[model samples]
Target: MAPRANPTLRQRRLGAELRRMREQVGFGGSELGRLVGMSPAQVTQMEAGKIGISVERLRTIAATCMCVNEPLVAALSDIITEREKPGWWEEYRGTLSEDFVDVAEFEGQARRLTTYSMAFIPGLLQTGSYSSAVFAQTFPPLPRHEIDLRTAFRMQRQRVVRSGTTPYAAFIHEAALRMQFSGPTVLAEQLGALIEDSEQSSVSIRVVPFDVSAMPSSSGTFTYAEGPIPELDAAQVDTSLGCRIFDAPAHVARFRSLLARFESRALSEEESRDFIGSVMKEMESKRA
Candidate 1:
């Protein structure tokens, strides 16, 4: 088969796992190639995500490498089986950055989601007008069409939270509550929407008040997506360039710990709802 010119995040992840397994067993590329009836170059290409691996081949590789993690192997097999399926984000593939599409893929496949935001409401919880307003503030001033496209993409991504099946937990800082992205009116509407969403049994919204004596030095926003198996979990963080996804065990663990810290410092769900109501009232009072 011809090598893939560009592989998606999931494809890359499968390749990484295969490479990790081989390394753990102390088998060099040429050595594994001989055992698997492939050339060393073929093994390298598969491990680099440039070439695909069949489920049978994957099983053979796992057996050769002495991997005993049945659950992880099954999860990897599922990924391979779903390789031909296209997600909703495919509609915007050429129009938007691949990173944007990857983020949507990550969120859509997750069993549960946890997010922490310090300066803005989590994208999944943002309302239409609020999201448009946030996009309008892009550093280089995006074209009107580009802004609209981004807003539409973001609104579409909220479906996972709206499905009412996937458990979602968001910890947003008090500072974000007062940012007034578009204005007090839009911010008020956004906060009101948050309260309504929090009413869902599967949704949890917690506010981290400014009064908290200590906050982590890392100010960036991040999301943790729980996979079927702990080893397959992924964490995503936004940077100036774009979203970065981390699936390595160590990175995922650190993100999990960071989210725990955020949760610990945030208000309870009920208290958060009351706090948000008060903020909405403050916004309304300002309008008066």
Candidate 2:
């Protein structure tokens, strides 16, 4: 088969794992190629995710590299098989940035999602108006048609929540809760929806109050998308530059640790609901 123009993160991840495994075992491209019955060029193509690898070949490489982790092997196999399936986000290919589509595709496949946001409501929980307000504030501002497309795209991403099967935990700071994205009414609706959504068995929303003594030293927003197995777990963080996906063992572990810290410091789920309710009431009073 021909090479993919743009491989999904999961596809790249599989290739990356193969390369890492081989290197860790001191196997070179030609050496590994001989063992896998592929030429060095073919092995390079597979490792670059420019081409696909058969499940049997992948297992051979894993075993040759001395990787005995059954779960990891199974996870890789699953990813290889799943790669052939097209994702819903693929429909937006020509319209949105590849990074945005990648994020959506990642969310769809994630078994569980944990996110922390300080400046704005996390996208999964954001209301239509709130998200529009956010896009409206973007620098070099987009055209109206573009803004509408982005808003719709974001709302589409919330389908995972509607499914009510994927586990989601959002750690939003009080500052984000207090910010009136479009206006008091919009923010109020957003917070109210948050409270209601928190009641879902699959969703957990926690608030980090301003009174908290310590906060995550690192700032900005991030989402940790857990995979079927630890090896496939990844963290997506947005920066001024653009979105970055972290999947290295060390990077994933650090993000996981940071999320744990936020979870411990944030309010209990019940308390958080009450806190949001109180904020909604305050918004009402201000508007009155």
Candidate 3:
């Protein structure tokens, strides 16, 4: 598949650029709001991508930014004029959280992905049985239809992973391997899938062993996605307030520091495979 395109931040940056240019011309957001005939808070939201812009507003923004070129005006217009949402996610909109859809598109467009999983194996690497069993236990008395939908969505996520173009690095906790997603058979298949996935030249899978004594990820799962522009890239975490996106350079830098600590503590792909294989064998021994 071609690289996925995520324009959300791009639109925000364009708006921010307009704000900065207006400021450079010595106009505050309120002053620019006067020029655009919109409220200051609306200008702020425009710069933040919380709202879209109309053609009249686009023209006003271009004028306020002292932009004379038709191309610049059209480019910003394109951001708003383009109505088509990515096909992969549109159908699932009502079923999934906004963050979930946003991440899917972001991952599609991302050139690099670094992930850490302390709980169960990260959903991106989960096999169907692992996904189904995880969700089954998650929501009590989950309807069969919901279970099926989640399983399908998870499998679709793995498609790009399997294509091997997106460079993915994962540091998974040792406990995730021992945590039974299903019976021994289901877990055996999941482990085997992880081993197989780790062999891909573009994908790196690491395990943080219990014996490691400590790892940076006692916190929670986080994903750091890299993009063409540094500021446009992001580090995402599911915080107490729920999933939040951090694109600010400092926040992203902090995540980088944490990830470095994690990667350094994790086992290499070969070692991780060996560790999981051992666990699988131990499970078999128990069954025997």
Candidate 4:
């Protein structure tokens, strides 16, 4: 009834671009509605990307927005094609957070990903037990079913590495390494896994040492992803309410700055490898 209640990134993008173009033309929503032979509310919904427009109608709207250039049309066509394709994550609906699904879908299509985590290891590097521990801490009273579902969702998301098509880079704070979520054994196992994952040629892991007090990203974790097309980049900052996604150049630039600052303080790959091994050894010492 509500147009299937789902839209692909491509569809969403095409709809967003069209909405932006419409607003740029100085036509009031009502006026545009009059022009497009739709109601003012419908025009607003269309511009807000709550619904889709047929190709012919989209072209007409583009013409009205004065963005009828061939290149613009070509980009729209590309988005449509992408939207028409079925995504792999669609089957996991109702089980994962909408934010999780959105992030995963975007990551799947992304060509590159950069993330900074000061409190915990980025989700990509988290082991199943580590993830479960983190989630438990967040929703300590959640039902077992919900916890299992969330953990499973996270593991499924980790399949990004298994995909072997796109690669990502992660930077974490040394504090994250020291923060023991589970008992020593679980923490030790997860730390060991991080070292193994870092061995992959495509992924890069760096750690900002505890002494680096001036590093950025002290507020919370955030991620930036670049799709195959530069124009498709999206930045996400985590918040207690949920994730806030930023596509504007200004926001993305700020996140990039945070990453650069953290990178400046982070240990080199070899140094981090040593640090990881050392942490594992410490866990072993505790066992002994």
Candidate 5:
């Protein structure tokens, strides 16, 4: 098959795992290509996610590399088989940046989701109006139509959280609850939605209050998606330039540790609901 102009994060992850397996077995690209009946260039392209690999070829490579991890092999096979499947996020491919679609895809495939937001609410739990207000603050002010498009897309992505199949835990700092990016009315409504979501059996919300003696230092907001296996886990951080996805073992490990710290300092789910309720009441009073 011809090379892909742009490969999704899933594809890249599959490629990385393949490369890791090859390196673990001490096989060079040319050596693995010879064993797998492909040229070194073909192996390189596949490893770079510029080209697709058939499940047959993937299994052959696994066998040749002496990889005994059946679960990892099976997970990789699943990703390859689903490579052609079009997700709901595809509709916004041209209208929105690829990062947006990638994030949605990541969330959809994740077995579990966890996020830490120091300044703003996690996107999965944000209401439409709150999302619009957040998007409006973009440096180069977005056109009204574009802002609306993004807000709509965000609302659609919330379906994963609402599905209640995959477990989701959100650790939000106290500062976010008090930030009035939009008017009090919108914030109040958003807080109300958050409390309602917290009631879901699969949803967990925790708050990190300012009274905590020490805060966990983080570069910025990040969402961590737990894959079918630890090797496939991914962490996504939004930046001024764009969304940055980290799947390297070290990076994912660091993010996991950061989330642990957030949990340690955060209020329990029950306390968080009460805290959010208090904040919502405050917003209601301000609106009055």
Candidate 6:
């Protein structure tokens, strides 16, 4: 079979799991290949996510490696199926960065999402004008066309919340709520949209007020996407160069903890709405 030049994160994840199992059993590529009836190069290719593996072969490898985790094996099977499916993000491939499409892939399959933003509302929760305004402020100002493309891409991400199936929990700060991305009118509309979305049974919006006595020193934005299984979860964080995604157990766990800390510092659901309401009123009063 031909090798894949660019494999999705899910495909890579499946290979990673198999590689981990092989390592646990103290088997090298040559040995594993011999046992699995494939060439050593084939094993290497599969491990590197350049080649696909069927569920039956995957199960055989798991058994040979003494991996008894039924749930993990089941999850691997699911990944095999998801790897073949095309996603909506494909339409915007060249229009956006590869990382952007990857982010959509994660969000599309996430069973639950937890995000923490200190300076801006997350893309998934942002309204059209708010997103366009945020893009406009980017340094080395983007071309008008790029700004429109980014805005549209961001708006597409809102389907996660609009679907009303995946549970979404966002922890935003007071500063973000006050930041007039597109002046008072647009900011007010953005915050109002947030308030309305918060009413969804599956969506939760929490605010971390500036007056809080003690809070974590860390200031960054991250999204933790939980898959059907815990081991498949991933975390995406913004970086100077671009967005970075982490699925390794250690990285994912740290992000999960970081988000939890942010959540703890945020106001309760009911209180968060009241806080947002006050901010909305403040904005309106300023306009008067």
Q: List, residue by residue over 34-135, the lDDT tens digit for candidate 5.
A: 999999999998998889988899999999999999999999999888746688998888779999999898898899999888788899999999999999
TM-score of 3: 0.78
User: Would you list the C-alpha lDDT of every candidate in the order shown?
Assistant: 0.91, 0.89, 0.76, 0.76, 0.91, 0.87
Residue 246 error, candidate 3, Å? 2.1
Across residues 1-288, which tens digit of lDDT does each residue of candidate 3 receive?
Answer: 222233354566566656655776888889888877888987777776666678777887777778776765675576567677655866677687666666676677677898887778887899899899988886346788988887888788776678888889888888888888677888878888988888889889999998986555345788888865564567767554456767766778888898889877788888998998898888777667
Higher-scoring candidate on lDDT, 1 or 2: 1
Which digits, one per residue and each the tens of the lDDT, describe model 4 over residues 1-288? 365366655556666667667777888888888997988877766655677677788778888888856666766666555544456677776666777777777677677888888788888889999999888887447777777877887788777875656687888777788788877788888889999988888888988778877665345688888754555567877888777677665676777777777777788988999998898888877877
How much is the lDDT of residue 25 in candidate 5?
98
Task: Pick out the ten consecutive residues of candidate 5 with the lowest summed lDDT.
Answer: 212-221
Question: How do all models score by TM-score?
Answer: 0.95, 0.95, 0.78, 0.87, 0.94, 0.93
lDDT of 2 by residue, 1-288 (tens): 887888877778888888989998999999999987899998888888889988998898999999999899998998777636587889999789988898898899899999999998999999999999999998998899999999999999999887897899999999999988677888888988899899999999999999998786765799999999888899999887678888889999999899989978999999999999999999878777
RMSD of each: 1.5, 1.5, 6.0, 2.7, 1.6, 1.8
- Alpha-carbon runs more than 4 Å astray in model 4: 1-10, 35-38, 55-63, 66-73, 83-85
Question: How far is 279's C-alpha from truth in model 3 (Å)?
Answer: 1.6
* Deviation from truth (RMSD, Å), model 1: 1.5
Tens-place lDDT per residue, model 6, 1-288, is: 799887876777788888889998999999998998889999988988999888899888988889999999999988776645488888877778888888898888789998888889888999999999999999999999999998999888889888898999999989889999778888888889999989999999999999986777653788899987898889888876778888888988888788777767779999999999999988888777
Itemize residue pairs with steric clashes in candidate 3.
none
Stretches of model 5 off by over 4 angstroms after superposition: 83-85
Write down the worst ten-residue block by lDDT for model 1. Answer: 212-221
